[model samples]
Target: MVGILLQPQSSPFPLLFLAAVSPPLLPALGVFSLIIILMAVTIGDRLIVRGMNRFRVWLTPWFKSQPSPWLELSWSLLQWGLRLGLWLLGVIGVLLLPASNPLQRWLLLTFTPVVNRLTSLLVTPLFTLGKATITLTSLFTLIVVSLALLLLSRWLRNWIKQRVLTRLGLDRGNQEAIAGVIGYLFTALGIIIVLQTIGIDLSSLAVLAGVLGIGLGFAFQQLASNFISGLTLLVEQPIKVGDFIEVDGLLGTVEKISIRSTVLRTNDNLCVIVPNNRFLERNVVNWSYANPQSRIHLPIGVAFGSDTVLVTEALLAAARQDARVLSHPAPSVWFKRFGDSAYEFELLVWIDEPKDFEPIKSSLNFLVEQELSYRGIEIPFPQRELRVRHTEELRLLFNQPTSPAPTSPQRPSQPPIPPPQAVQSSFSAPGQFAQDQTLRVLLRKVAYFANCSDAELRVLIERGYQKFFRSGQVIFRANQPGDTFYIILSGSVEVLSEGQWSPNQAETPPLAVSIDPKATFIQVENQVLATLSKGDFFGEISLLTGAPRSATVRAVEDTILFVVDRNALQKLLQEYQELAERIAIELAQRQQVLRELGLLNQEDESNPADKTPLQRIRQRLQTLFSLSDRPGWPGHA
Candidate 1:
C-alpha cells in the first residue's frame, strides 16, 4: 500500500496524511468506527422503542378489544426481533458502503476476517461425548434454555396460584402448596427436556453431580431443614395464613410462608421474618387456630378493706357493659388469693375475637377502673417501704416544728344518692328483670302492649334501645318525621310546640294558640301543653299513622326512656295483628284530644263517618309496614 501511494494517483493525501498522524492508530481507528456504528444502532433501537411506547396509548384505540395474553407476549417478542434485525441491517449498510469511501473500505477489510474467525470458533467443537458434541453454540443454547425454564416455572406457579387454585375454593395455604409443588415438577421436567434437546448426556454428569452434592450437602444443611419444615407446614396444615400466632412472646398474624421463612404482620403493622424451622421447633401459641374465640383472664387487685362482693359486682358490671364479652359464657370473678397489700381477683371473661386481644384488654381495664371508682372500691397500689437505722432521729424529724399547712378547699357536695327502693317503684311488675323491670312495667301501660307475654316483652326490650336523655334534651320536634316511640320509665317529659297558649285558658291548654306559621321546631314556647310522667308514653300517633310529629317532646329532667322505633312497631304489628287495631284506636283518641285543643282540624267531626281517622290510620299502617301480606293480619288475605 505504501509503494502504490508513492506513485501518483490512488488518493495519497488522505491515506498518507492519516498514516502520518499516527501510524499505529490507523487499524485501531477502523475498530473504533465499527464500535461507534454498533453503539449508534443500539441507541437508535432504544430510541425507537421509547417512541413506540409513548404512542402505545394512542395505538391501543385502534384495537377493538384487548389482546389475549399469548398475543401480547408474541407482540413483545416481535419488538425484540425487530430491534435485532435493525442491528443486522445497520452492520450490512456499513459493509455495503462503496469502495470509493476510504474509511468505509478500510473498516470492511479490517472487520470481515475478525467476524469470520469468531464464527469459526463458535462452530468448532470443544469436546465430543459419544454421539453428542459440545460447542459454543450448544453452551449458549443451554444457558438460554436454563433461563427460559426458570421464567416459565415462575410464571406457571403464579398463574396456578392466582387463576387456577384460587377458583378451586382452596385456602391460601393449600393454593400456595399446590402451586409450589407443580412449579417444582415443571422445572425438573423442563430441565430434562432442555438437556435432551441440547444433546447433553445426563449419564456423563454423574461424577460432576457427586462433586457438587458433596459441597452443597454440608453448605445447605440448615437450608434443607428449613425447606423440609416449610413443606411440612404446608402439608400438615398447622398454622395457616391469617393465623394469630405467638412464638417466643412475639405475637403476629401469619402473612406469608415461603420455603425459607414466614412473614408475620404484627398488630403494630410491622412485618417480621422468622425462619421456617423455628415455627416447627419452637412452641407456637395459635390464638386463631380452629376457633378464634378464647378466654382472657384479667388479674385485678383491690384494696384490702374493700368489700369483696362489691368488687366482684363492679368487675361483673364492667364485663357485662362490654359487648365483646360473650353473654353465654357469663363472665365470673375468681377470688384468687389474699395478697400482702391487696385481695387478688381474676376476671374470667370469654371473647370471640382473639386478634383484638390488646384492645379488648385495654377497654376492660378502663371499664373496671370506672366501675370500681363509681362504687368507691379502691384499686390497690404497690407498697413501698424505707428503713432507717436510728429510731431517735426519725422521732426528732417528726417532732420538729413546721408551718401549719393551709387547709385545702373541699369539693362541692355531690347530689344526694337516690334510695334503692325509689328505683323499684310501682313501675315494676312481678317477675320482671331488675335491669329492665321499670321499662317492662312502663311498656305494659301502653294499651297496645298490655297483653304481651314475658317472652314477647323480652324480645321487644332486646329490640328497642334504652337511651338516656339529659334535662332540656329535645327528644323529637314537631314536623320531623316521627320514627321513634318513647315510653318514660323513671323520669318526666313535657310535650310542647312552637306557640303561645291562649291567655284565657285555665290549668288546661287552650284549643288554639298563637304561633308563627314558618317557625322552626327548635323554638318551643314556655307554655307546656302536657306533662307526662312515669309509665306514660308519647310519639304513638305519628308512629302508628306515619305522620310527622305534631309537637316537640323534651326531657323534664335527666330521663331514661325506652325508645321503640318504627321498625320494631312494624314487626310487632305483623306478629300480633290485634295490636295494630288497638294502636289505631289509641291514635284516634289522641287525635280527638288534639282536636279538642284546636291543634288538629276541628271538622273531621267525622261529619258522620266518625271512624274516618281510625280507618285512615289503619290504612297508613298497612301501607307503611306492608302488613297486608302478613299471614295473620286482618287487612291481609
Candidate 2:
C-alpha cells in the first residue's frame, strides 16, 4: 500500500514518508487537511470582506454629490473586485504549496480537472453576432463595458441637467424636455456605438429592427401618441408644472410632465396620473393661461318689492369692499328674469387672480347678506299659493242652498290720505334738499369711520368739504405726497396701483390719450387694482402715516367725495386712542393679507404685534410730514 501511494508521484517528500507508513491513513488525513485549508480560506475571506466594507464606508464621502449613481456603482465594483482578488489569492496559495505536501497533492488531484474543464467551457463559442463569434469571456467583457458606459452617461446627463441647464436660466419645462430628449439620444447612440465596437455591423440588424419597430408600433399606438403629446405640451406651453387646470371636471395643478403621462396634484392632496393625450384631445381649462385674471359671476336675489336701484347699489358696494375684485372692469349688476318669489340678479366681477374666485365669491355673498339686511331689503324664499275645489264641497254646495250672503259684518273705515303739501313735506322739501343730512348718513355708512361717535361724525361733517369729479377724471396720482383723506359719498372710483398696469408698460410707453385726465399733472401711471363705490374711503394710510399716496385714484363714473384735511384726521385719532389701535390692527391685518396674495412687498413675516407696523406708521408721519410736538397730537414726542 505504501508503494502504491508513492508510485503516483516522482519525489514523495512529506507524502512519501506518510504513505510509506500507512496508505489507508493518508486518504483520511488528506481529506482532513483539505477541510482545514478550506476553513482558513473562508475565515480569511470574511475578514478581508469586513475590511473592504470599512474602507468603502470611509471612501464614500469624497463623492458626496447628490444622486450619485456612479458612486454607488463604483463602491459595488470595489467590493466585488476585492472579493475576487482575495479568492484568487487563496487559490494561488493552495496551488503554491510544495509538490510533496499532502494538501497540495490532494488539491491538484481534485481541482486540476475541474479547472481545465471550466477553461475549456469558457472558450467554447456560444453564438455569432454579424462577423464576430462571441465566447463567454468576450460576452462578459462586453456586458461590463456596456454597463460602465451607461452609468457614466447617466451621471453626465444628470450633471448637465442640474448644473448646466439650470444656470442657463431655462424654465423647468424646457429644461426637462431637453434633458429627456438628450437622454434618449444618448441611450440610442451609446447602444449603437457599443454594438459596433463589439464587431457587430449595424447594417445587418436593420431588417430585424424594422420588423420589431413595426410590431411595437402596432402594439403601442396610444403610447406613442401620448409621448408626442407630452412633447407638444412642453413646446407649446399650453399647460406647465404649477399651472392650475381643469380637465373632465377634475381640477388640479400640474405637478410633473413625463413622456407618457402627466401628474396632477388635486386640492385634496391626491395624486392623479393623467395621460398626456387626454390633454391634447379633450377640452382643458387652464386658469393661469395668458394671464391669471378671470371673470366670475355671483347670483343674488331680493324681495320683489325692494327698490331695484338700492339693490344695485348694495351689490356694487359688496363687490367693492372685497380687495380681490379688479377695479378696471368695474362690477356690473344684471337683472335676470323675475322669479316667482324673488327678483334674481347676477353680479359680474373680474378678479386679478383666478384662484381667488371661489373665496372672494363666498365672502361677497356674506357681505351682500349683511348689506341687504342693513338696508332693510329682504331675501324672500320661494312661495306658492294654491286654491283647491273639493268634489264633496262642490256637491254639498250644489245640493244645499247657500246661506252665507244673508248678513255681513261692517268693515273698518280706511285712513284718509294726507294733503299734497303735507305729503310733499313728508317725502322731501320743494327746493331745499337735505344734502348735508345725506352726507352725514353716507359718512355713517363708511366702514373706516363706522366706530366714530355721533358728535365726532358731526365734527367731520362740519370740517369736510365735498368735491365732484366727472366720469374718467383723475382724483389723485400715485407716489404723490398727500395730506388729505377722502370718502366716497356717491358714484364709483378706481384705485389703480402703479406697477401692475401693463406687461410692457415700461418698454412700450403708455399710449398718449388725446385728453389725459391726470396727464396734465405728472401723468397717471398705474394699473386699476380695485373699485370703490359709495361708503368706500381712500387716503386713510396717508392720514395715519403721512406717507405719499401708494396708488392712483380715478373716477370710474361721475362721483362725489368728502375731503377731510390732515388736521381733522389727526384730531380724530388724538381724541380716540382705541380707534388708533383698531386702525393699527386693521392695517397690519391688511398688510399680512396682501403679502399672502402677493400684493404687498414685506421682507419678513414676523409676529403681527412686532413694532414694525406702528413704528412704520410713526416713522412715516415724522419723516414725511415733519410733525413736531404739538398740543393736540398724541403721536408727537
Candidate 3:
C-alpha cells in the first residue's frame, strides 16, 4: 500500500480531485472545527458554573441582602443556557466529521447546512432588533407555561381535596398523600416529554427500567404493600375518619389515614399510630358503624329486703323521664344476681346516638340515686358484722339513759319560778337565743311555710317543742288518733303503715326518711304524707284533715323533732285570721306546685275535704268584696 501511494500517477486524477473538494473545504472545515472547540469549552463551563451558582444561591441565604428574584432569574438562565449550549455542541460535533467518513459527512453537509440556514434566518431578524428577542421570548413562554401549569396543578389539587376528598369524607392526611402522588405522576410525564424535546433517545430505557423495578421491589416491599393497601382502603372504606374504634384493645377516634399508617386519638388524649397492614389484620370495633343507637347497661343493687317490683318500676320511670334516653326501645330491668347483702339489677336503656352514651349514663346514675332515695330503697354498702364479747362497762355506756335528768334540789337551791315578764325578757336576749336563729332561718326555708313572716315564724318556733327518741322508739302507733304534729330536729324516723293494705305490701316495710335537726313531722289523718328531714316541714296538711293518724312513726336513730301542737296552731289561727288564711292559701299553692312537678302521686282520695276557719273567712270576704255581678266568692266563681 505504501509503495502504491509513493508512485506517481500517469493521469492527473489525484491532483484534480484534491483541487475540487479539498481546497473549497479546508478553511471552512478548519474554521468550523475551531468554533466547535471554543463553543464547547466556553458554553459548557458557563452552563456548569451557572447551574452550580444557582443551586448554591437558592439553597444558601447567607450571602444575599435580597435573594428571591435573583435566585429565580439565575435558575432560569442556567436552564436556558444549558439547553441552548447542548444544542450548539450537537450541531458542531456533527459538522466536525471528515469527508472521508462519507455517511457522517453527507449527513452533516445536508442536514447541517439546512439547520445553519434556518438558524441564520431566525437569528438575523432577532439580532437586528439589537436585543436577545429569541431568548426573551423563550424565557417568557417558559415562565408563562410554568405559571399556568403551577396554577392549574394548584386548582386541580384543591378541587380534588375539597370537592372530591371532602365529599368522600377523607382526612387531610389522605388528601395530601393523593395530591403528592398526582404531582409525582405529572412530573414524571413532564420529564419524559422534556427529554424527548431535547433529542434524547428512550429506546435504551427498557433495560434501565427492568433494573429499577427489581431494585425497587427488593428495597420497598413494605412501602408497596402499604400503598396498595391505602388504595384498597380508599376504595373499600372499611374504616373512616371520625369513627370511634377499638383495635387491639386501643379504643380511640380515628384522626387520620395515610398511605403508611392510620392515626387515632384515644379518649385519654393519646395519639396512636398503627401500620396500615396491621389495621387490616386486626379486629376493630366501630362504635358508629351501622347506627349510633348505643345501649347503656347500668347495674344497680339494692338491699336484700327491698321490694324488687317497686325498684324496677322506679328505675323504669327514671329511664323514661331522662330526655337523652330513647323511648322507642323501652328500657328494661333484669334481676341479675343475688349477692351477699343486696339484689343486683341491670338497667338497660338505649340512646339515640353514640356520643350521648356517656352523658346519659351519668344522668341515669344520678336519677337512680335520687329515685332510690325518694322511694326509701336501701343501697347497701359493703358491710360485715363483727361479734364481740361485751364487758359490763360497754353495756352500761351504750345502754345509758339518753334523756337529761331533772335538776336536783340538793345540787343547788333554786329561785322561785321567774315571773312571766322576767322569763320573756331572759329568753329574748341576744345571747340567750343566738343559736335559735338557725332554727328560725330553717323554719322560713320550709316550702310549705315560705309565705310566713319572720315574726310569725319566730312565734311558731317559740311555741314549738323539742323531743328526742332513741332508735326503735315508737313516736306514734298506726290507727291512733292524731293528737299533734311532730317536727324532726335531728337523726331519722321510719314510717310504718298497717301491713294489711295490699298496695303498701308491695312497698318495702317501714319506709324511713332521714330527719336531721330542724325537721318537722306532722301527724296527718288517713295518709302517710312524708318522712321529713332537716329543713323540712309538715302538719299544715293536718289542719286540712280533722281525722286520726293513718300510720305509725318510729325513730330509726336518735332523732330530735321540732313539734308544733295542733292546739297551739288552732289558737294561733283564732288570733290571726289573716295569717291563717295566708298560710292555708300557701299550703294549697304548694301542693298544686308539687303535683304539677310530678313529685306527688296522681290518685283520687275518698275522704271528705274540710274547709279551714281561715278559708271560710276568705270566702266571706270574697263574697263581700264582690267584683262579679253574682257576688260569688273568688274561688267559687
Candidate 4:
C-alpha cells in the first residue's frame, strides 16, 4: 500500500481536518446545522411516534362505528413512507459533501465499485427469449410490482365497498360482489400491463405458466372452489345477511361472507366460521327466507276419558289468548292417537318469529294448563296398573312382618295407593318422608307420586334447573321469598329454624371512643337443626302458598342442587293432585312450630282459628296455579 502525499495546496486546513469538518467547509457546517436542527425536531420527544398517535386519535371517531381495514393499511404505508423519505434526505446530505474531503472520498471509494458491479449483474440478461430477455432487474421489478398491485387491489376493493357501493344503498352482498369483481379486474389488468412494460412476452411464459398452474391447481383447489362459491353466494343471495338459516345442522344468522369463508352468529352469541363451499354443498334451511310465519307443535295429553271437544276449545282459547300466536293461520288441534294411559293431541300454532319459539311454547304451556284447569279437565299421568301376583317381596322391602292372606279374598281394584310411611328415622323431622333418591327416581318410587307417569316426571325435570353453591352459601333465609325450593342432588345442606340462637360467632359493639380488647361481646346465630345430604328435598309447602319461609337452609359444602321455582312447583303439585293436601298439612305444622318458637314475622300474623293452614294453602294454590275448584273442606266456613 502506498501512502498519499499531503495535499496542503487543496485546502488551508489539513486534509484530514477538512474531511472531519466536511467541505465548502463554511456552507457544509450550515447544511449540517440545518440537518441537525431537523433531526432534533424530528427525534425530540419521538416526534414520529407522537404524530402517529395523534393521527390514530383523529381517525378513530370517523370510523368508530365500524372497523376500516383500508384505514389501517393506509396508516401503515404513511409510517413507512415517512421513514423512507427521511432516510433519502440523509443520504442526499452525505453525498452533497465536497468530493476532495476524506469522508466523501471514503464513501465513494467503498460503494462505487460494488454499485457498478451490481448494476452490471442485475441489468445483464439471465435468459434471452425471442421477443424479450429475463434479467435480475426484471424479476425484481415483477416482484415489487406484484406487491404494489396487491396493496392497490385491497385498498380499492375496500374503498369501493365502504364508500361507493354503500352510498348507492345496495345490499352488503351486492356491494361485496361489485368490489370483489373490480378488485379481480384491476389485479388481472395490472399484472398484464406490468409484464408487458417489463418486456416479458406473455406467449414466451405459456409453458412455464402451465407447469406452475398444474402445481397451483393441486395446492389451492379447495381455496379456488371456496372463493368461487363465495362469489356465487353474493350474486344469488339465497341466504342474505340477518336471515336465520340452518346449515350442516348448525342454526344461526349470516354475519359476513368473505372471499373464502362465511361467518355465522349463533343463538348463543358464538361466531362460527364456515367455509363458503359448505353452503353450496350442504342442504340449508332458511326459516326467514320469504314468509316469516312458521308452525310450532305443542303436544298435550290428558286423562283417557276427557272430552275431546273441551280439549280442543281449551287449546284454541289458550292459543288465541297469547298475542304471539298468529291469528291468520288459525290454531288447529289434531288428535294424534290414543296414548297408553291418556289421549295424545298436538296443538299447532303459527308464530311469526322462530327465534322466540322457546319462550312462546313456555308461555303457552301456562295458558294451556289454566284453560284445562278452568274446565276441570285433568291432565293425568300414565297410570301403570301394578299387578303384584306376590306381595311377599314388597312386604319384606317395607320391613313389615309377613301378614297372613287378606281376609275374605278381597278383589284388588287398583289397590288404593299406600301412604308414604312417616319417616320416624332421626334423619328428618318428627313426621316427614326423607327424600333418599333423585327427584325423578323419587317421584317414581314414592307412594304419594306413584300416579305420575314417565312423561309427567320428564316435565318436572325440564321445568327445574340445577344450581351450584359453594360451601357456607345460604340457599334460603327464614322469612325470605319462599317461591323457590331446592332438592339436594349431590351435596348436603343445613336446615335451621328462625330459630334457636346458637353462640357460633361473637362481635363487640363499637363505642363512642376506642373500645378495649376486653370489651363485652354478644353474638347469636341460627341453631343447626339438621344436616340433610343428597336426595333431600324441601320448600314444597312454602312454594305452594308463597308464604314466608320458617327455616334457613345453607349449603354444607360445594353442592349441586335441582331447584324448582313457584310455577314449576305449582305444575308439579297439579300433576300430583292427591299430594297437595298432604303438603298443605305439613306446611301448617311447620308454621305452628315457627309461631310457638316466636320466630314468625309480625307480617305473617294470622287468625289460625278462621281457616286451617290446609284450607288457606289450598285456596292460595288455586289462585296461584288455577287448579280445579273443590268442595269445602272440613274447616272451610
Candidate 5:
C-alpha cells in the first residue's frame, strides 16, 4: 500500500513541486479554507435559524393581535426563504469537497449528501407547494386582513381625533380629514408590505403598470372625481354630517360623507345616494353650513273680524311655548295679505338647529289651531260669492203657486183670525210673555236642547233668571267655583278671564276676547242667562254639578242674558245622567284650556308628585300582587 501510494503519476509540473504544493501547504490551505467555509456555513445557518425564530416570535403577537391570515402567510414566506438559503449553501459546500480524501469524503457522504439531497428535493416541491399555499392563504388573508386593518386604523384614528385632537381645540373639519388620511396611509403601507412579501415585485411590473394605468383611467374616472371632490369638500366644508341640506330638491339630513358619495337620510326614512360630483355641481342648500340656526315661517289666516293684536299675541305665545325657538331674537308675525275671506299672516321664528325645523313647524301648527280656536278666531276657507241677477220671468216662476183643479183639491178652507181683544191682550202683556216666548223660541234653535220638549224648555225658561250687561262687563273669574254655565243670546259678548288680562293692566286684556255678533250677555259666576237674544242658553254646568263657573264671560257690547238657577239645573241633570256626563266633558275641556293659559293650577290626581305615574302604578302593583324582582311592565321601573 505504501509502494502504491509512492508511485509517481504523470503531471505537468515536477514531482517535488507537486509534493511541495500538495503535502503540508495544500493540507494547511485546505484546512484553513474548510475552517472558513464551515465557520461561514455555521454562522449562516445560525442567522437563518435566529431570523426564523425571531420571525416566529414576531408572528405570534401579530397573529394574536391581528388574527389576519396575510401576516401568517408572510411569516411562512420568511421561514421558507431562510430554509432555502441554508439548504442551497449546504449542497454547494458538500459538492465542493474532494472525494479522494477519506475524512472529507466520509463527512460529505455521511450527512452532507443526505442533507443536501433532502434540502434540494425539498426546495422545488416546498417552493411550489409554498407558493400555492401562500396564494390561497394570501387570497383569504387579503379580505380578512384588509377589513381588520381598515377597521382598526379607522377606530384608532377616530379615537385620536375625538379624544386628542378635538379636545385640543382643533378644527373638527381638519381633524376629520387628517384622521381619514392617516387611516388610509396606514392601510396602503400594510398592503404594500404584504404584496412585497408575497414576491410581487412592483418595480419589475412595467407592462402591468401601463395596463393598470390605462385601466384605472378608464374604469375609475368617477372614482377619481369623487376622490378629488372629497378633498374639495374637506377644504371647503360646504356640507357636514348632521347638517340639514336640500340638494337637488331633496331635503334630508347629511348622514355620512365618503370618498365616492354622500349619504342623506330624508325625513321619510329614505336613504339617498348623492354622487360627489353632483354635490359639487348642483345647488346645495346647506341650512347649517355658515349658520346652524334656521328660520321657520308658519303662515296662518284668521277671519277678518278677528282682533289682529290678539291673533298676533296668540301666535307669539304658541311659538314661545316651544323650547326649540329662540327668545332673544323673538318671534314676529307679519300681516302679509288681506285675503278675501281671512287675514293672512306669516309667523317667523328662529331655531338653533336646522334639523328641528320640521318638528317645530308641526308644533307651531298645532298650537296655532288650539290658540285660535280658544280665542274664537275663525280660520276660514277660501270663499266665493255668487251674485244672482233675478229676471222678471225667474221671479214669476218662483212666486207662482199652482192651484189644484176641482177634481182632487176642491177649495182650501179659510183660516180664522183671532179677535181684536185677544190680539190686544197678547200685545199688551208683551213684557210678561216675552220671557217664556223667547225661551221657547230659543230652545227650538239650540241643537243641544233640540230633544227637550216645549214643556221642559218652558219650565227651564220660567225657573231661569235673566239679566243684561253693558259693553265690557266681568262675566266670571277663573278657579272660582264652576257655577252658572252660559249660552249667548242677543248682542255680541266677549269671554274674558283673569289670566287673559295683562299683568300690566294698561297693556291689553290677556284672555281671548271676541266680539261675537251672534252672542248676547254671557252668564256670570253662578247664574244662567236664558233669554239671550234669539237662541242661547247658559248655566248648564250649574245644572249638572252646581259647581262654580270655570271661565268668565263679558259683554263686548250691550248684551242680554237668561240666567238659570242652580236648583233648576240640578233637577234637569238628575233627570238625565247622559246630559251630566256631556257637561262634565265640556267642563274638562274648558279646564284644560284654562290650565294651558296659566289660569288653572289644579294638581292632576292621576299623577303623584313623589313618583312618576308609571312608577307609582308599578309600586302599587308590586305591593298588591306580590310580584318578584324580575322584569316589570314596559315603561315602569
Candidate 6:
C-alpha cells in the first residue's frame, strides 16, 4: 500500500529530557489526548443528531408533500457538514492558543498525523486538463457527480410529467406519450454528457454504429414494432386511459400505455399487461369509443297463437319500466320471425352508459319474461314429432312389455280462468295450505283488496301463485322487477330502503337461510323502511305505478306469501273498475306515510293540485289495461 507521507515538523518534547526520564511520557500523552478528542467528537455527533431529529419533525410535512429521496439526502448532508464545522472550529481554537501552552502543544501533536495522511495524494496523476491534473480521486469524483446529475435529471423529468403536464389539460394518452419521449431524450443526453466529462470523443463511437445497427435489426424487431405501435396509439387516440375496451377476447379498462406494453385493469380488479403491438395488429372494440350510448336487443319467443299486438305492448312496457332505459330514443319491439312452434321477437332499447351493458341487459331479459308470463304468452321450446312405421319387429318389441320408459317431466300449464266463487274463511298459520283457501284469505287481508267481494277474491286466487320463504331470504333485490305484489299470510318480512341500486357497487353476501329458518337473521345494510307481519303487503307501488322496486324485502321468518302479479290485477281491475278510486286513495295515504317516514324521496311525493290522485290512478290503470290511447301514455303503440 502507498501510505501518505507527511513533511517532518519540530517535536514539542525535548530530547535531553526524554533521555533523563528513560521511559517517554509523550506517547502516553498522545494516547490520552486521542481519547479526549474522540470523546468530544462522539459527544458533538450525538448533540448534532438530536438537533437534526427535532428539525426533521418540523420539516416533515414539507417533505411529505413533495417527497423525494434526494431531498432527504440533502438534509442529512447539511447535518454532517454542521457537525464537521463545529469540530474544525474547536480544533482551530486550540491551535490559536499560545505556543508555550501545554493544551496547544498537545492538540497539535495529537491531530497532525491524521491531517497529513488525509492531505497526501496516494496515486500518480493520469493526464492534465489545462492547470488541473486528472488523478484517480478526481476521476472517481467525476463519476459520482455524473451519477448524481443523472438522478437529478430523472427526478426533474418525473416532477414535470406529474405536476406540470398533468395540469395542462392534455389527454392521459398524450401526457404519457410526451413523458416517454422526454425520458428517452434525457437518457441519451445524459450518456453523451457523461462521456464528454470523461474526455471521450463522441466521434469515436461512429466505428460501432454499423455493428449496433445489425444487432438491432436481428434482435429487436418485436421491440421496434411495439414502440412504433405505442406511438401510433398515442397519435390516433383510438383508446384513452379510461376507455372500456375488448381486444382479442380480453375485456378491461385501459390504465396505462407505455412504449412496449399497455396496462389494463379488469372488472375483477386484476392487472393485465398486454403488448402494445397486439393492440395495433388485432381487432379492438372500444365500447365508449365516441358515444356512451349503446343499444341492447333481447331475443324472445312466444307461442304461435299469441296476439302479436299484445306481445309488442308487453315488451314495450317491460322496457319502459326500467329507469336506466333511455326513453327519447323510444324502445321498440320487432317481430323477428316465425319458427315452427313459436314467434320470435326482439326487444330493442338504448342505455346511456356502456358500463351498464351487462346489468341492463339482464334486467331487460327478466322484465320481458315477467311481462310475457303476466300476459299468458307462453315462451315455447323447439318441438318435434317422431313417426314410426308399424313393422313386425317393432310391434314384437313393443308387445314384449319390458319396464316402461321413464318420461321427461313437462312444465305446468297456465291455470284456467276460474268461475267466480264465494269468499273462503281465513285459514290457520303457515306451512299448511288447505286448497287455495289460505291464499284467498291472505289476498282479502291486503288493503288494496279489502273491499273485494267473494267473486273478485276468487278471480285473484285463480291467477295468483303461492311461495314459501325462510327467514333472511332475499325475495327480490332493490331496483329489480316490481311486476309482482306480495302479501304475507302467517309470518313477517323486513323492508330495506335504499337509494337507486347500482349492481357495480359493493354487495352484501347472500343471506344464510339454509339452516333453521327461524334462527337466521339478516343485518340490513340500508335503512329499515318498515317491518310487515301477517296480513300486511308490499310491492303495491311498483305494481300500481309500473316502477322498479323501491326497496328490498327479505323474509324475517318462515313466511307464506300470496303473490298477485300485473296481469291478475289488470284483469280484476277491468272487471271491477269502481275499485280504482279506493286503490288510489289507499296508495296515496301510504305514499304520504312513506314520505313522512323518509322511505320515499321528494320526487315521488304527491301533487294533488296538478292532478288528483284518483284521476292519475284512473289514467295509469287505463294505460296498464290498454283501455286508452292518451298522448303521454307509454303503453301507446
Compare the candidates by lDDT and give the number of the best one. Answer: 1
Considering every candidate listed, which one attains the maximal TM-score? 4
What ranking of all candidate models by TM-score puts the best one first? 4, 1, 2, 6, 5, 3
Residues 1-637 of candidate 6 have per-residue lDDT tens digits of 0111111122222342234222434343444554465467557756776777786675454221344455556555556567667666545443343432564565468878886775565345777654446677767766566656655555565666678888998766567667656766786788677767666566655655676878887799999899888877766878877678889988888887766888888877798999999998999988878786778888888998986766765687678778898865667667899888799888888887766678898898898888776666778889998888878889898789688778978868987755434222243322332333344456666787878776677556545555789988989878786788987867999988754333333564343223333433443346677999877778877787676776789898999886778887877877766666567667667756545434455653355345544455556667766553444333343
Runs in model 3 lying further than 4 Å from the true structure: 1-222, 267-272, 385-637
Count of backbone clashes, every candidate in sequence: 1, 0, 12, 0, 31, 0
Models, CA RMSD each: 16.5, 21.8, 27.2, 20.4, 27.9, 18.5
User: Roughly what TM-score does model 6 have, to 2 decimal places?
Assistant: 0.44
Residue 238 miss distance in model 6 (angstroms): 2.5
Query: Which ten-residue region of model 4 has the weakest summed lDDT?
Result: 1-10
- Cα deviation of 216 in candidate 2 (Å)? 2.7
Pairs of residues at least 3 apart in sequence or in different chains that clash in candidate 4? none
Better of 1 and 5 by TM-score: 1
Show the colliding residue pairs in model 6: none
| Tens digits of per-residue lDDT for model 1, 446-486 | 77777776545544554465568999888987778877888
Query: Any idea what lDDT model 6 has?
Result: 0.67
lDDT of every predicted structure (CA atoms): 0.71, 0.68, 0.59, 0.69, 0.60, 0.67
Quick one: ranking by lDDT, best first? 1, 4, 2, 6, 5, 3
Candidate 1 global lDDT: 0.71
Better of 2 and 3 by TM-score: 2
- For model 2, residues 83-147, the per-residue Cα lDDT tens digits are 55655665555445443266566657888999999998888889875677778877877777767
TM-score per candidate, chains pooled: 0.50, 0.49, 0.35, 0.50, 0.41, 0.44
Between 2 and 6, whose lDDT is larger? 2
Q: Cα lDDT of model 5 overall?
A: 0.60
Model 3, span 62-105: residue lDDT tens: 32123335344544554545555655554445344563355456
Stretches of candidate 1 off by over 4 Å are 1-85, 93-108, 123-135, 203-207, 323-330, 384-637
